[model samples]
Target: QFDRKSQEYRALKRYWKLIQQDSRKLSDKRFYRPMFRMHLTNKEILEKLLSYSDELRQHYELYQFLLFHFQEKNSDHFFSLIEQEIATVNPIFQTVFKTFLKDKDKVLNAMELPYSNAKLEATNNLIKV
Candidate 1:
């Protein structure tokens, strides 16, 4: 029985790792909408898995904001949104907000740049070959 339980645990761990990989892929434009739709359908499961954490919910909101509305012109609003999401009660969220505040100028400068790192990733792949 112990051996069988251990095997099941290992299988679950492997499955979770695969899910993480697929979740990362959702950042790609082609996968974003479909994965987001699936996530809405599985909202209850996701909420439970995220442990009903308010910090995680705030982070998810920020992520969605960036994913959909990111542009040079919106940089000010982005930082403002980050400021609004900073929670006084959560040390982790507070630290993250502090870091962002500290590097605000640098981040704003990068946002104004015309180029994106998406193409740079392709160049990196070519260099690795």
Candidate 2:
């Protein structure tokens, strides 16, 4: 309905060029596919992206999702998300995440979850009951 017009917007338009370069892309078939070739240091670059602004903190989830599909060794992106999500953690969160990360195979287990899906599911089940 509306449009953006400004110098920052113009410069930021550049990120759109390679935005699709993210290792994860959706195929025409609506399935997921991973990219194999990526320039080195991409991981560091993605990490640096988070360092830019606190307002962008909300995007950490998207960064991790992309890394899972597109990156094999971009530790920067992975660690950056961890640092952002955990940096200001309270004592309860700190202890819970410390234990959660102990097992990497439990992928659905989330350390930074603000809303527990389990609780949501339980609420739905209660309504059904």
Q: lDDT winner among the candidates?
A: 1
lDDT of 1 by residue, 1-129 (tens): 125446434433333333233233343222322322443323333443344346555555566675444443588777777787676436775787788789988777777776668888999999999
Alpha-carbon deviation at 44 in model 2, angstroms: 10
Q: Assess candidate 1 and give its TM-score to the true structure.
A: 0.46
Best TM-score among the predictions, by candidate number: 1
Worst lDDT 10-window in candidate 2: 27-36
Query: Candidate 2 at 47: error in angstroms?
Result: 8.5
Model 2 clashing residue pairs (backbone): none
**lDDT of each residue in 7-124, candidate 2, tens digit only:** 3344334343333345344222322212213333444333334445454434444544535732454444544555466656555655654654564334333433344588889999
List ranges where model 2 is wrong by over 4 Å: 1-3, 23-53, 57-61, 69-129
lDDT at 58, model 2: 45
Error in Å for residue 78 of model 2: 13
